[model samples]
Every structure is written in C-alpha cells, then in structure tokens.
Target: MSTERRTKVLEVLKTAEVGASLLVKGWVRTKRQNKNVAFIALNDGSTINNLQLVADPNQIAEELLKLVTTGACIAAKGDIVASQGSGQSVEMHVKELEILGEADPEKYPLQPKKHSLEFLREIAYLRPRTNTFGAVYRIRHAMIFAVHKFFNDKEFLNIHTPIITASDAEGAGETFRVTSLDMDNLPKNEEGAIDYKQDFFDKETNLTVSGQLEGELAAMALGQIYTFGPTFRAENSNTTRHLAEFWMIEPEMAFFDADDNADLAEEMLQYLVQYALDNCQDDLKFLHDREVEENKNKKESERPELYLIDRLKFVVDNKFERVTYTDAIDILRNSKPNKKKKFKYLIDAWGADLQSEHERYLVEKHFKKPVILSDYPKDIKAFYMRQNDDGKTVAAMDILFPGIGEIIGGSQREERLDKLEQRMDEMGVPKEELWWYLDTRKFGSAPHSGYGLGFERMILFVTGMTNIRDVIPFPRTPGNAEF
Candidate 1:
C-alpha cells in the first residue's frame, strides 16, 4: 500500500484533475468480472455513492481479483479518469490493488440483493453498508452536526448532563435504575424495605429520562443552554414510535416566555429542514427515492400526500399554524371523525389528551401545514409548566408535523417557587429528591422556556422513514438490544 493519503469516494467523484494518482480504500459493494476485465464498486462510508474501480485481469492476479467480491475490503492505487460508463461521471483506473479483508461469499449475510428492514435490523452491524441505511445514517450524522451548529450559532451553551441522576425528570416512574446492590442478598432498612442508602451512590438513582430540569438550572445561569444526549425510558413499548434509549435535544432560554419559546422552536425546525435540504441532498435524494419505491405499491389512500424532499421544502418555506389547545379541542370535537366514531380515542371532552391520530388530523387535514398546539391542560402536562390564567391549563406547546405528530414539546416554566412546589405536591413528586432543581427557582428564577426535540423523530421526518428504530443506530427497544 502507498504511504499516501487515501482519497475518499466522495472526493474522487468530484475530482477535476483527471489522471491524478489516487489511493482509495473501501469495502466492495459489488464486483463484476469478465475474462479480461473486472469492475468493482467501492464505498468507505464517505458517501452513499460508490467509486467504480476498473481493473484488468491480465495485470492483477486472478486470485487477488477473486477476493474483491461483495463485502470485501480493499485498498487500491488508481488514477481518476473520465468514465466511459453511463451512470457515474468519473471512475478510477486501478493499477495496484490490496485485499485488506475478505468476505466469503457463502458465509456473508449481505449480498448484492434487496433485504427487508427487519432482516437488516438483525444484522445492524453491516446495515450501514446498504444503500438505504447508509443514506439514513449519513443524514443522521448531518443532523447531529446541524443540531450542534444551530445551537452554537445561537450562543446556546452545550451542557453535558448526567445520564444517571437521583430524580426522574418526568416523574413518570418508568426509569431504568442504576444500582450497585446484590439482588440475592439485598440490604434492608429498619422498615424491612430495600435500603437504597446502601447503594453505590448512597441513594436510589436511575438513568435520566430527561435533562430539562438540570438544563433549566444552567439556563438560569448561562441565559441559554441546550443538552443533546441520550435519554432513557423504561416503558416496555415495542411500537414503531418508542425506544428504551433515545436521544433528546433540550434547549432552555432564560428570559423567554411561551410565545418566544414557540417562535424559537419554529425557527429551529425550519432551519434544520433547510440545512438538510441544502447540505444533504445526495443522501436525502437516495432516501427519497427509496421511500418512493417502498410506498408506490401501497394504496393511493395510504401513500404520503407529499414526497420526502417536497415535505422538507414545504416545512422550510411555510409558517407553522399556531393554535390553542382549547380551540383545537373544539375543532376536534366537531370534526367528522369524532362525530362518525372513526377515531379510536374519541375527542369527547376538553381535557382529553390528544392522540397521534388527532394530532395528525389537525396538521395533515385541518391546518394543511405544520402546527404549534399550545395551552395544554395543567394536569395533563408536567409539573414544571407554567399555569395559565384559566388555572386549568399550562403554557405548554406541542409542535406537530405532517407525518409525525408532536415533533417537539416545550413550555414556559413555573418560575414562582410557590406555584412550582404546589404543583410538585399535587403530583406527589418528592421535592426533597430534586433539591438542586428547586434551588434554581428559589434563588434566581426567570421566566424561562424550553422544548425537547426527539433526535430520532427529527430523522424520521427528514428521511421519510416510518419506523424510529431504523433512523437510530443500535436501537434500544423492549426485549431487544441487538447490534
């Protein structure tokens, strides 16, 4: 192998200087051989597109060329040339080839053929090598960068919140506990209950379900802060929308109210959509076509109203319709679905929690655009949400999208210690557990607002992928944690 830098397939495809010596190394996607010539498609995760390598069997050993099958890794010294092929504009004329690794054709799970998403999930370690998942992951990475960039550009401090904490941010009681105690011989207190005091942290702790509480504390000091990290949920849900471990992007602004929070969330969503359209077109296009092919055979009623690229552009170009939860309830109650009993969870009352079907109907049918549903009932929302003048609803908002409902959920916080403590008591949440969180409200609390954007959900929208498991790599789900 040459001691020179390797040119990525992405760069190789864009090379203007033809006949330049280039060293490219990647796993072979496909290889076709004739009696005199052999062609190899190589990719190194630099791009979804592959670098076409042309080799002469007369020059390279037959045995060496035979090893360059599908899933084989190889290093090649070649010269970039204008391709005579129809698809790619340029190709590499390989002069020397080195087989770094070989995949036995008989044993390799993946071949040059189509595989179901379920089958691919079984072998997720190699799924990135596929066109569909490679595109998904590439877009995933672009969004990860875009997330940090969007926050950094707005001067929001990126805080690394603890994964393990003593408090459940959501107070839902569904949390994966983190303990260093023997189960067989558990320690007990005087009351004969399992004593958490003897645990590793000297108290009961679990994987954090959200970082918004701690993020709120930082926002109180830093003015604006965001936490982008993995959040866990112990709910045993195996649905398409849920995961045991997923990522969250929570951004808190100190001096912002409910309206300001909604505005910022809207701007961020538009910005992310625009960024993906501008920067990740190639990968997005691949996913777009893949989505199209996947949905083409389905009934017309079941297909998406707009394609992936079109929907992304629509989000960037249009303003989200802002509506109060009360008004939304009135609309839903009077809607045809509710009247005809089409909805599984009928919208009968004002305090009813809006289901995914209702949210989708509002965005896809009623609004015909993205929406910001605000002023949720106080009891339905978290204890931290600011109570409105009605005393029944909180200043909570949920941003609903076309295909996905409730892409983001945020609200203006209850800065007043009295109100917050009262709500905490009403919800039976022990204030003593989150002493640090309460300290922020007691000392220097401001009218802060924040929202959480599910990272995988964002990817689902951008990639037009139906299942949340496919967007995230190594999905942690109930009864499954396979690679």
Candidate 2:
C-alpha cells in the first residue's frame, strides 16, 4: 500500500500532472468487465464526474474483484494516465485494491439502472449517490453559498432568529406547538383551559413560521440584517410546492421602503441566477438535460418554453416587470384565461387574491419574464404591512417567476405605533403577545422593508425541478416524515 494521502476524484481529475502514484477512495457507481480487464466507475461526491479505474483480471484477485459491486466502498492505489475513452480525460491504473465494504448485489437497492425520482425519494438515504440528486444537491449547495456571498458583499450582517417564538408574525395561526408538559395530563387554570403558563417557556410557544419579526428587531439595531434558517409551518399541505419544514432567506433593511425592497430582491435573485450559471455549469447542465428528457413525456402544451439554462439566462438578462395589484387584476381580467374560464380561481375583481395559475399566467405568458406585483389589498395581507395612502391597499409585493409563482413575498412594515396597533386590533391579533415587536415602533423605529424567499422554491426554479421534496435533503410534509 502506498503511504500517500488519499486524493478526491475531483482533485485528481483536475491535475495536469500525470504518471504520479496516488490513492483514490470512493463508492462504486458502476462496474463493467470485458474479456481481459474490468473498468470501475468511482464517485466520491466531490463532483458529478467519476474517475474511471482500469484493473487487469490477472493483477486484481478474483475474490477482490467480486466485491466491487455498485454501492460498495473501496480504496485503490494507482498511477494517473491519460484515458483512451471519450467520456473522461483521465483513468487510474490500479496496482493495489482494497474493499472497505461489500454490498450484496441482490440486497443493494441502487443497482446500475435508471430509477424513477419517486423511487429515489423512497430511498432518500441513498439518493445522493444518483446522478440527478448528486447534481441537484451540489447546485443547491452552490446557491446557498451564493446567497451568503451576495448579502455579505452588500455589508449585510447574518443573523440567527429564534426558531421558537411566542407570537405569530403572519397571523395565519398555523404553527406547531412546542410543549414539555405531558399530553395525557395537561396543566389547567381556574378557567378550565390548558395552562400554557406552566409550559416550557413559561407560556405557549411554537416553531416559528417566519423569522421576519425578529429579523426586523435585529435590523432596527444593526441597520441591515439577513436571516437564513429553518422555518416550520403546521399547514397540512401536501403539494409539490409545500413543505411543513423548510428553509427561508429573509433580509431586512432599516431605511428601505417598499420599492427599495423590491429592487433589492430582484437584484439578489438575478445575481444568484448568474452565479449559478457561472459556478455550477456542469451540474446545471446535467440537471438541464435530465429535465429535457423528462419533459419529452409531457404534453406539447405542458412543456417548458425555454430549456433550463436559457430560462436562467432570460432572468439574468431581462428586468422583472413591475405592476400594481390593480393593474395586474385588470390585465388578468381581460386576459384569455379569464375569458375562457381556464383559471381555477378566476381573477374577477381588485380585492380577490391572485392564485398560482394567475401568477403563472402573468409571469410566463404576459410578461415572459419575472413579474413583481405590489400594493395588494390591506385586508388580504398581514397586519404589520404598512398601509398605503389609499387605506385599501398595503405596501406588499410578491415576486413571481416562470415556473414558480411567488418565490418571494415581502413588504414595508408599519412604522407608526398607533396605526400598527389599530390594524392589530382590527385583525384580532393580541397586542400584548407582541409587546416586544411593538416596542421597536414605540421607541426608535424607522422605515424598514423585508422579504422572504423560500429556499427550496428557489432551488426548484433554478434546477428546473418541479417537486419541492426533491430539492430538500429530507422533506417534512403533511403525512410523510421519513429519512
């Protein structure tokens, strides 16, 4: 055995130096044998590319070669040489082979065959070894790095908001309660209700649905802050777009208004898209080709207008179309979808909330680019949103993209205490529960705006993948929470 330190397949493949002896260790992706030699495709999760290992049958013992099945882990010492094959540029001539672990051919679920995405989801533990998932996750990581890098470049401080919060920011009342008290025998007060005062936090608490509330507090003190963390929602939605537990990227700026917020969101998204196009070219190409093949089975009308890279380039090159909710409603009402009654929820009036179908129509058909719809009706938005001059609308914006509707949602916050309290009362949100939130407005609050981007939704859009579950490592949905 060579005493040299092991090298990752990516590192070895990128080296221009040849004829150097080295050790490469990874899981077997595929093993094929010809009359005189065996070729083993090895992957170390470093990159989508696998290093080809050539082993002469006379050199490698038969018992050792028998253990080199798919999913088996092995270490090989070899000399780097130029490959004659067209798929890759380099190959390893193995002089020493060691089987670290053996996988039973019949028992290993990930055989050398194309498995459906649904089947891969069933075995998520092993799905990362697959090409589709490998590329997806690498691209996911690249996007995550790009997000932090983007905000860092803008002098934004990264803040960690509380996962457990006492107040609901969105007022949707969809939360998963966190309790240490026994469920069978709960504490009660004289009112004959469960006494939340006896719970873990001395009051009721639940996994936060959004970090925007706390993020605002941080921004008020820090001037500019961004939060990237896990958020939970108790809404039992089992759709391709919804996840019970997922990640959110929220950024709050102290002096930004509604328009400033929209501009920042658009710039950040375009930057990330451009970053992915530059940094994750190989992985994106793999996913793009995969999506193209998958789309072949779909109806002609249901197919994507542009391929993945082209779609991303479209976003990077063009500016997002901006429109008011009223104007959007006018456009939608006069559009063909509404006239033909094709939308599931028809856009009939100004106050009606726009559905996914409506947003897609505006983004994909009307604008042919990203669309930012602002000034939604106040009653349809949260209590904290700043009321517009008209009193019927709030300074809220939702960024809609071609494949995904509302990838981002944000708004200018109510800075005046009285107006905020009045809206809180009108919405039936207890003011006492959010005393800390109101204190910011009472003392030193300024005009602030923020927006939240669902991290998985962004991944889905970038990867051209349709399902949110596939983007996340382990998805927590309505009825499924398996590893």
Candidate 3:
C-alpha cells in the first residue's frame, strides 16, 4: 500500500500544536547516532532551515538507521513533538523509516562546513543544495512572482516579444546570427558574398538583443505593456557585469514622459526590494550569515555587509540618489583623486559612455547609495531617446548600484516624426526596414518612455555574487556554454 504524505516542513513548522502524524521525505543533511537514538537533519528545499528527526533505534532497527547518510533521500512516518534539545523548537519522533536512495558519504562533495563559491560552480547541478545559492534562487523566484503580480495589478498588458529578429535594438553590432546551412559549403552571390537566402529563414535573422522595440509597438496599441524574456549579445568582453545571454524586463508606457518613466522604475524597484525582504526573510538571513562567515577570514577593514538582506534593508529605508549626467560628470571630475587609475575608459568627457568603474564610483563612493543618472549625450545614447531642450543630450537614464554598476537603462522615446527621422538618418539606420515604426508616429503617437532591467544583474546585486555566471543557470558566455 502507498504511504500517506501529509504536509511540507514549512507547513509543519507553522502549526501551534505537536503530535501530528505526518510523513517527511527529504535528503539527509546530517545524521548522528547513539546507542538507542539517532538525530537526522533533513532538508526538503522548503526553506533554509532543516527539520530535526529523532529516530528510536530499537523500533526503526539499527540497519535502517545505519543506511541513513548525508545527501541520502529517505521517507519517515513520524509524530511531531516539542523538542527538549538546544537546536530546534520541534523534532520528529520517527515510528517507521524507509530508505528511498542512498548517497555514499565518501563521494558526496558537500559537507556541513563551508565551500567556496568557485568550487560550487564546478558542480552546478548540486550547488542548489547549498545555503547561499538556495537563498539566492528562492529570492529570484519570489521576485519573478512579484513582477507578474505588480504588472497584473496595474492593468498592464503582458506582451510576448519575439526572441529572433532581423533588426538590432541597441545597434551595437553585437548580435548572434542564426543560420542553418553548413559554413563549409555555402552559395556565393555575384559579389562573392555568402548567399543568406539559403538559410533556414530564407533570409538573415539573429537572436534579439532587446525586446524594447517590440514592446514599444505593443504599448502604442495596448496602452501599457511589458516584456520579460531572454536577450542575447555576442560581445566578447569578459567582465563581472556582461553576460552573453541574460533576461531583461522591458516595460513601455504610451503616454508617459521622462519623469513618469523614472517614477515607474523607482516604484518598481522599491516594490521588488520590499517584496523580497518580506517574503524571504529566512532565506535573506541565511545569506546574510553566510556572507558574514565568508568575510571573517578577510581583512576586517575591507569587509562590509554587502549581502542581499543588508542591501534590501538599506533600499527599503532610504531614498535613492538622483542626479543628471552633467552633474554626475562634474562630481566625478572633482573626485578624480579617489578614482582608480587602472580604469582607462572613463575620462570625465561630455559625450562618453560611462564605464562600470565610473558608475560604481558614483554610487558607492560619491552617493553611498543607489543613484539614477539621467540626460545623457544623444550622440552616445541610442537613437530612440527623446532629444532634450539643449539638442545635444537625450532624456535617458541609468540606475546604478554600489556593488552592481548599471542595473537598468531606460529612456523617453522620440515621438516626433521629423526629429526621429533626422536622428535615424544621421545615425545611418536603415530607414527602409523601420518604415512601419516611423509610420506609427504619422498615424497616432504620444510621448512614451520605457526601460530594460537586467534580471541577472539584479540577482547578482542582491546576492553579492561577484560573477554574472553564478546567478544564471546554464550561463552562455564567450567560448563557454557548459551546462
């Protein structure tokens, strides 16, 4: 006969009374035995804390108790009772136990002690069992749920954007071309160019770099829309911030301007931070303690509480810093002495793209908090950004954090037909391809704005994980796609 399964460990802990007959199935984290009793720490991936199981040696049999080892999957029929021990508030008194799967302790890599993050990445399949990653991913899941809820409550339409497109959104020339024909044998045109007509799509196509353009179209028709999906970039730079394939959330509003866009982004971020803090308190606390322990061996002067829990608390309690690009440049110029010399790209120029180091310095050193840098030079920004009054800059914004530099990039789109055409022509954008997009302005258009939030970058910021590869499952980077 099949045994009965009552409730999860999280649900069991929520109960007030004990002595409830229940069945628990989970991997054994730690097991210790005396002459007549054995203590087993069981984890069901329900939460950070494990359930304590007290098994009677005489009733369960010594052979069954001996079979229990670290990482072994087991099921126990037990009655919960108030614990008299020092570890937990409640413990399970096992009446019958059965071994579902046995894991050899000699081969199991995980132990009760700490393991390096680098070491854990090598065993990616098993890293979820650890405390830090478990907490990080749990928060990630919760954040995703909160995002859907926020959009749903606001009456925003969820638009499903295409993953493959023929046009480039960022126009950065970093795109992964999609093809089916073998590279070794290809048809050549009269100019000795490879014939793309023989490709799978019968023409050139590529993985989309951003869903902002499509999202904008939907927003114009549906009023407000958002797209949350995977975006790909083929750039080869190996940095803590860059990922070849990452998730991006792009929300577009049809009748909003630059200030409205900023307000929406700020509200969304605050809501997400608060949601994580409230829903995953235990997981956040677990990550906080793990971060503290990891910093114990390092120099005390260099260590700080940069983990998820602390960062969430700080964001929830304080206001985010906001400054225009011109003022930001002035601040960076005045604070040049504190800037690292190894950063070769940031020169405090008027029309230069801000590097990660410069962004970090602005948030961490100058502001000591998250900052929104807005009104960037139009020449340096994308073609879609609305032109400012000065005609030299665009109404664009980037939200920067202390640990993670640029977590978000957004802009007020250019809705004027003539001005947008001029900008597109000057930027050498193929006007023929974007004729439909340009016609949207001719038919009916209003000032609109949106932004793209890098989902992995946000996770990295919250978890204090240094590398972008760690936060993403099955990361695809330059020359690396190992599952």
Model 1, 89-207: lDDT tens digits are: 88888899999999999999998999999999999899989999989998999999999999999999999999999876567449998999998999999999999999999988999
Cα deviation of 18, candidate 3, in Å: 0.8
The stretch of ten residues in a row with the least summed lDDT in candidate 3 is 337-346
Q: List the lowest-lDDT window of 10 residues for candidate 2.
A: 164-173
Q: What is the C-alpha lDDT of each candidate?
A: 0.91, 0.92, 0.84
What are the RMSD figures for all models against the true structure? 1.4, 1.4, 2.1
Q: Per-candidate TM vs. native?
A: 0.97, 0.97, 0.94
Query: Candidate 2 on 1-483: residue-level lDDT in tens?
Result: 435689999899888358988899999999999769999999999989899999998999999999999999999998999998898888999999999889998999998988988999999999999988998999999999999999999999999999988776567549998999999999899999999889988888899899999999999999999999999989978789999999999999999999999999999999999999999888899988988998899999988889999999989999999999999999999999899998888877779988888888998889999999999999999999999999899999999888878899999999999999999999998888889999999899799999999999999989988899999999999889897
**Cα deviation of 16, candidate 2, in Å:** 4.6
Model 1, TM vs. native: 0.97
Instruction: Report the C-alpha lDDT of model 3 over 221-240, residue by residue, as the tens digit.
Output: 99999999999999997887
Q: What is the lDDT of residue 291 in candidate 3?
A: 75
As for candidate 2, its clashing pairs are: none
Candidates, ranked, lDDT? 2, 1, 3
